[model samples]
Target: MTSDPEEQVRLQGFGEMTLRTAVATLMQLAPGERADAAIFRVRDDVRLAQSEIAELASHWGIEPAPNVRSPGLVPDQHWPDVVRGMVREAPLPSLMVAFLVGMLVARR
Candidate 1:
């Protein structure tokens, strides 16, 4: 969206400041070489991984959305740690588990 001039300006109004504007403003304050445009996109297959995680947690008697915090089970706070521990204990599905946990953490 930042590539298009109009969209860049519109994004700024929406508080999604464009990198182009930030770089330009910075350049004026401190002289520097011309800046380049950079865009980033993140894609995650959360549905599949989350399903797998829930299935695993269920086997461990940890409800997918557990309310209580307890050892060897899902905790309300730092719940992602519980998920990661389960993933590490299992020999299989390590990659998928890591990805799911990462997606969960990043979203939070």
Candidate 2:
């Protein structure tokens, strides 16, 4: 029901976490069941799509976002047109990653 796209994504992430927790609890409660049985039970009871459990497991187990690109190696082109505009009259350093990669270009 939110008009904000960021809010909707946050809500969706919260809902996914709740569902994952519930499924994990149920799996733990069924002590005698096989791992595959627990997966099937979750699929049948919660009506999730095929491979979604595996996908969720993979996603949840992933490490936090990697530092793929280094911050110090930013292109020279961004220094002029983009980085100069986000400056505030404070001591905080400018964040150029979003601007260098075009994330903040259209918004400005």
Off by over 4 Å in 1: 1-77, 93-108
Judging by TM-score against the true structure, name the best candidate.
Answer: 2
Q: RMSD to the native, candidate 1? A: 20.9
Compute the lDDT of residue 66 as modeled in candidate 2: 33
Candidate 1 lDDT by residue in tens digits, 36-64: 22222122211223233234334434432
**What would the per-residue lDDT of candidate 2 be over residues 1-95, giving only the tens digit for each residue?**
11121221111112323444534443343233313333222223434432554455455552223333566775566666554664653344334
Candidate 2 segments whose C-alpha is farther than 4 A from its true place = 1-17, 26-46, 62-108
All candidates' TM-scores? 0.17, 0.24
- Residue-pair clash count for candidate 2: 0
Clashes of each: 0, 0
